[model samples]
Target chain A: MTLHIAVLVVLLGLFFVLPAYHVGAFSRIMVLAIYAMGYNLLFGYTGLLSLGHAMFFAAGMYGFGLTVNLFGFSVAPAFLTGIIAAAALALIVGYLALRTAGVAFMIVTLMFAQTVYLVILYFGEYTRGDEGFVVQQAQRSFAGIDLTGETERYFAALILFAICFLAVAKLVQMPFGKRLVAIRENEERARMLGYDAAKLKLHALIISGAVSGIAGATYGLLFGYVGASFSTVQYSIFPLLWVLLGGAGTTIGPLIGVIFMFYLIDISSGYTDAYLLIAGVALVLLTLFAPLGLVGTLRKRAFPWLP
Target chain B: MLASLEGAVISAILVLTAMGLSIVFGVMRVVNVAHGEFFMLGAVLAWVVTTTLGGHPVFGFVAALIVVPVLVGCIAAGADRLILKRVNYDPDRTIVATIGMLYIIQQATLMTYGPEARPVEAPFNTRLSLPWFEFGDEGFQMIWPWGLSITSYKLFVIFAAIAVLIALWIVLTRTKIGLIMRATQQDSDTAQAFGVPVGKVYSWVFGLGAGLAALGAVLVVPIQQAHYLMGGDPLLLAFIVVIIGGLGSLPGTVIAALLIGMSDGIISVFFSPTLAKIIATFLVAMVLVFRPQGLLGRAPS
Candidate 1:
């Protein structure tokens, strides 16, 4: 318990202080962490690997963008609308995709996400296509308070991240989470045990979709722009990497992985033009040496005391 | 009329890439996400040999078709021995690992080649013209038989792709190594128990897949320029093909590839490219929902 509190304190302190030195990097880390956490709920806990998570993320961004630019909604309302739209999209996609498990599920989700990406890419009129949608001013105000400043947005993101993290943690401990775990471990056995595997998967996917949508909304709001690139297959794959690198089953793993990966990319980009190469090398090394991920390694080494 | 030929040409290219992808997936149960990267690598190497070394483009392409696969195949063999060998039969971990490999290879290519599209001119540019027919304000010109008006290069691509597919079919059906591969794919553990070197077979299978992808790249480079990011478009299409055909069924993959390629080509020609992709993707999702084992894939026993 003391360890958990201490860790949280250290994390929160780092989050608040890091922006002082590098605001952009810090924001990137937070947003990615949020995204990874959302992914963690579906992949790490629920045992459903969704390769097209970017669909929900992009849906949220587009939802928010459309609401703000087209409908003239306020930032808060637009954000809510984005979440709702993402949830709806997730429900539909999940319904069809969750029918298959493992590789098929991964490919199906990826196909859908890529389709969305292509749609956005070719339909230049509505999405502004490849050129992307830009926010003219970052000075989004909520109830007349300027929420556009970096510090304000950063704090807002942090608060939202915390809430999302807590929500996911809670969901994982619930009955549905247990069913998800059962399905992950052995679908046949779970079905024999009388659990509706598809329904459980759907539930988990919806939650996953909602969380990913929130992450996308936060990303758009923070960056003050959104584009088709956000919906690409690569973007969809990032959270999966984060979940894997962090140790999928653990609550803190995704967050830890996100922070580590974001920093790795940020730091490596400065040294070499081949940031992707460095990151890829790191991933290969991690997968080869530490399949269980960094958190798993740490837990094995340091905390033999906990479950 | 010309559009139909263009569609046929594009379909042929897609079929070639998809066939290699399908065979690899069928034999190895490994969804080599890096397959497209191998294709791109072949194109890049071919471009280098032809343009940088001042070699004949055709010879360079042929060299790439032979060499790139051997090189990538060796790397894939290493991947099999060092990485995939460990995660054998664990589909989830394998998928994750392959995705990791995909990113690594993609980035490595980008680092080596830079993120730019380099044009590799085809060795030949012979267009065949037939008797012209008059249309409203335009003359309907026929270039080839069956109302198909396609460039000679495209015709070459079609013939080459068909030849490769037929050759692959023969190899898979007739050869001793092919027999072993079939046995291994059917049941790796059983095959190993029966004295087949499953490890060697796996290495060979990985190499074979990489080689096929490289061959496709050699064939395709003229159509689409050799670019660092060239693999992405084809990779998505290949994935769709693989899913539609069934995960590990080569014939199924071929059929799915043709179906998807033709539909995608036709749709892109008639409607918006975006809508075509959406339709194709919708088909995949529908297939998954209705036939999770795929069009020809058998359910895991």
Candidate 2:
């Protein structure tokens, strides 16, 4: 844990002080890390692989961006609304999704996610469809800090990531977290043990959704853009890959996964336009050979307390 | 009438693809997410062959019809050996693996064919007019519908799908290989005990499923145009059909495809295309909620 904090401090220094640090990329990594953290709670720990978390993420982005851009709301209010919107969406999608299990859940969530994407696209006049929407007032000062300032944006994302990391860490250690694990291990057994598996799964979904929303809002703020693109299956897969690649159920695994993938993509993007092909190949290889992912495999093979 | 005809054409295309998907699901219990990429491959291959031939459209199309599916089947068979076997058809893992395959195929196509949507010239496009009788001031007057006329190619597509499906039915029923496949599908361990080559059967099944998708793509590319991105909609539609129709039931698959096809045609023409998609996607959620076993699937004991 101390090591984790030390790493965070060094990252903060790089973002705030180091001239060589790419704040834009760091900010993106932090935002996605938060998203992956939320995803891990459901997928890694709870063992529910939702292929439609993009809906919640998109909801958060659109909620935050639209509120700030259209309703003239301040940053704090918009941020809260984004999380709320995502949690609320999770409530609806989770309720509907929990009616099924396994593959059905995956397909149902995917279909519903596509539904959301189509809805957003149909309302292109408002959301700007394929072209996407830019938040003109995204640079507006919030809490006496200039959000337009690179360091300020980076710090904002970093602080959010820290809170999320702590929250996920604490949540997984609680009794509720144990219940999530039990459900993941065996839902029928958990149910026989008098635990409400459905309710617990729903709780995990809601928490994950809200965290993803927070990440999405941060992404919009840092980049000043949000669009229907976020609602696609591709976006949902990003977090899944990150969680799986880094290590699901491990708090620091998500950060490691997101950072590693981001850097890999960044470096390779210059060489080939088929960078997505690389990502695809990596996913297949990892799923086939390294199911436990980088951190999970390492912990199992050698270091028990790698995280 | 025209809307329903359009629906039939769409359903024909769907059946060609979804049957392969359903067979894979039935035999291996793996939901191949990259199944749509086969459809894209079919169209791309067809485009390559037809464009390369560059002479009589009929000759070029006929060559594509024969060659594209065989080529796609070989690729899928190779993939099954290389990747699916390693994963051992683990349901969840296969989904991700197939998704990865989807991207690899999509990006490879983008690199090779570029990003442009290309049209394949139809062998023949003779538009036949339909006569409609309307009561005017003088009474019943016969008039030919203008845009209601459809090219003969669409009719050929519907007929072609029917023929292929019939051939598939025959192969599954009359052939010894079909018996082996059925045995493998029913009980893999027992089939293996009986000296049936389960691995070879799996590769063949995967190839067959991919071939169906390719066949459908080759038939439809004349109307829809060929693009690397065109596979997504067909893939999603195939999933809905396979799920709703009952994953291993070929008859059920055809029935559900027809239902969705007709509805897609009527709804998109009268309402809006987006509305049709919304309703269809929404229906999938409902189907999962109320009837997870699907329409024709046997209930689990």
Candidate 3:
């Protein structure tokens, strides 16, 4: 618990102070960590592999983008709208997808996500297609604060992440979280025990979707734009990688994975522009040998006395 | 008339890709997400051979039909032996590992070929017009003085795909190796206990599926051209086919492929392409909800 608190404090401090050291890299890492945590809840804890997480994430971005740019809504409402839109979308999609389990579920959800992506891509008149959406300076302010500025955006993102992290931590300790674990362990048994497996999965999906939505909304607000690329299949896989790399089923694992991946990519993009190859190799190795993930590995090593 | 032929041609192309995915999933129970990457590799290889080796494009195509699958098959076999075999039937880990493999293969291709799309020259480009077909001031016209017209390349694709399907059916049903593969699909442990070399059978099945995908790649190059990312689209389409066909059901896959292919082609022709995809995906999701086993798939035992 102390370790967790310490890590949280350090992360919060980094979010506030990192802009002084380096603006773009630090902010990017923070957003990615938040995104990974959302993914970790669904994949790591719930054992549901969602290949289309970017759909929810992009939903937030587009929701914020549309409300702010086209409808001229305030930033707070835009962010809330993005989260609501993503949650609603997740509810519908999850209701359908969670009906089936295993590979069928993964493919179905992914296809649905890809379908949305195609719609966004081809409906050029609305989405601007590949060109993407740009946010105006006037649109970036929340009351008196200028969100367009990096420091303000970073702080805004930090607040959202802190709230989401607390909510997830609390939820995971509740009875609902135990049911999720039961569902993950043995779906048939869970169903036989009178647990509404589908409903539980849907709950997790919605929570996962809501968190991802916030991440996406934050991304758009901070970056001051959104685009079709944000919702592509590549983006869908990003969270999965983070979950696996950091350690699925562990709270801190995803954050670690996201930070590591972000830094790795930032550094690698400078050298050969083949960050994907490196990431892929790392993922394969981790999946093969360290399936418990980084935190799981640490737990095993440090707690040799307990077991 | 030409529209019908066009539909037939497109259906044939989709079937080729779908069948390979079906076979791999059906036999090995490993969803080869990288299957489409093999197809892309085939197209790229054909282009390289034809352009560089100074041969007929058909010869290059044939070479790709053999070489690309063999190369990818070896990699897949290694993946199965080194990683997948350990995980066995654990779908979650297997899916993640395969996804990891997908990224590795995709990035490798990108690294080698770069991100730009490349074109492969078709061996034959001539259009074959039937004497019976004709069109007038009306929106449409038909046969016998306005009969059917088709591209020679499309006809070739249809013929090639049919031939491959026939060959696959024969291999799966008539051969001893095919029997072993069928047995393994039915029950891996029982097949092994019954003296089937389960390991070798898996490698062979993976190779066979990869080869079929490569064949699809070679056939479609004339129409779609070759590119690094060409595989991603087909991969998604194949996944839909597998789901609708029912897992491990070969005949079911064939029917599902035709259904989806025709639906996609016809719907896209009539409506916006984006709307067509959304509709198709929606239909699949509905089917999954109501009948998870698919059109012809038996209930999971």
Candidate 4:
């Protein structure tokens, strides 16, 4: 664990010190990694494959942006507001969607997420509809730092990502995390064992939503823009791809997956417009040949205690 | 009266598309997320055939109708053998694989056909003004209702959907292949033990399902322009209908399609399209909560 942290620290340090090559781009990846990790909490650890995490993420972005725009809130306060709104949104969506199991759950979440998107698009006055909203400048940062500056934004994203990652790590070691795993493995069995499986799943969903919301807030802050595109069904599926690619149920796997995919898209888009073809083919091939993804594959073949 | 007629047309299209999805889910237990892409491909095929022949629109449309569904069916069958067979129909994994398939097919179309929306000229497009009846002292008065007109091609679509559905019913009930499919759907292992070629049946089912969806696209593309990205909405709508009708229930799927289609048509006509979508999606969520088995769906054992 310490070794992994040591490596992450050095890697982040390089990004911070070295010439700031596309720092915004790297910041985007960090934000996405944070989003993916939040998704992994529900999908990987708790075994709930939600199709509407985008709703939570977008809720965070729009919520935070709205607070800043309307209420004149600063960075951290607006970010908190955005995340709390996302968690609340998750509570409602999850409660409604979790009524059914398996495929029903996936489809229900999908429909609800899409419905939220329609609502957002319909209420264009607030969301700006297709026009989208420009994120207000964060007037204040933590302890006298200027968040509006580009380099400062990168550090803010990096710091938030680390905090969320560590929080996940600590939580997964506790009894609550063990209960989540139990629910994931066999909800029926867990219920038979007297666990409040639904409540536990709900909690996991809220935490996951909150984390994803924070990532969305960070993304809005870093990019200074928010759009309905982020809440699309495509974006909902995007995190699933990242989690699957990284090997679900692992802390480092999502980060690895995000890094690889981010660069994959970045590099491939330069070569051809059909780079999505590669991502598509990769998804099919991976599901067929490498269902466990990078971390799971390594755990099976080499370092067995990877998670 | 015009709204109801339009609703019937919409229901016809929905029935055609959702039946294919229900059949595929029932027999193969794989939700082909790429199913909508087949519909898009069918429309593209229709456009290609129509434009290339460049003679009488009727002649070109006929050629497209005959060739497009079969071609799409073959493609689907090939996909089944190569990809789905390899994946072995694990629901979650198959979902992702089909999403990949969706992106592949969509991008392939975009690359080949370009990103422009292509219009298919209807073979016959004589507009017919619908007559409305109002209750009066004379029991009923035939009155022209506010200049509501429909194209002949749309009427053909309504008839074609019904004919195709009836033919499908005969095939499923009266034909040997249909019997094979139903038996396989009911219990694959049992059917296999009884000398049914379950693998062949699956491929045939997948092809038939895609072919049906393609046929719907072919019928409707003349009215609505065919584009690479147009597959997503139909796919989502079909899934909503299929899920509500209960996965793998043909009659349930058909009924659900009619309900959704009629409502969608009428709502969009009277209210906003976006509101119609919201209502439909909300209904799906409600069904999932209140009655997961759907209107006519059989309960899982």
Task: Go through the candidates in order and give each one's C-alpha lDDT.
Answer: 0.77, 0.89, 0.79, 0.87
* Candidates sorted by lDDT, best first: 2, 4, 3, 1
lDDT of 4 by residue, A1-307 (tens): 6755874696587676766666777777888998999999999999998888899999999888888887888777888899999999999987877778777788888888898899888878888976788875544455677677877877787888888888888888799999999999999999999999999999999999999999888888777888888999888988999999999888888888888888898898998787788778878988989898999899899988876
Provide the lowest-lDDT 10-residue window in model 4 chain B. B262-271
Question: In candidate 3 chain A, where is summed lDDT lowest over 10 consecutive residues?
Answer: A298-307
Which scores better on lDDT, 2 or 4? 2
- Which one wins on lDDT? 2
Judged by lDDT relative to the true structure, which candidate is superior, 1 or 4? 4
Candidate 1 stretches with Cα past 4 Å from truth are A1-8, A15-19, A136-139, A304-307, B52-58, B130-149, B296-301
> Model 2: what TM-score for its first chain?
0.96
- Across B1-301, the per-residue lDDT of candidate 2 in tens digits comes to 7877888999999999999899999888889999999999999999999999889999999999999999999999999999999988888898889999999999999989989999999999999877788998989999897877778999999999999999999999899988998999889999999999999999999999999999999999999999999999899999999989987888989999998888886777776888778888988888877788789887666
Q: Pick the candidate with the highest DockQ.
A: 2
Give the alpha carbon lDDT tens digit for every residue of B103-187 in model 1. Answer: 7777787777888898877878677754545553556653335553456888888788888889888888999878998999888
The candidate, 1 or 3, that scores higher on TM-score is: 3
On residues A202-286, what C-alpha lDDT tens digit does candidate 2 reach at each position?
A: 9999999999999888888777889898999999899999998999888888999999899888998899888898889889899
State each model's TM-score restricted to chain B. 0.89, 0.94, 0.90, 0.95
Given candidate 3, what's the lDDT at residue B36?
A: 82
Candidate 3 runs further than 4 Å off: A15-23, A192-194, A303-307, B133-148
lDDT for model 4, please: 0.87
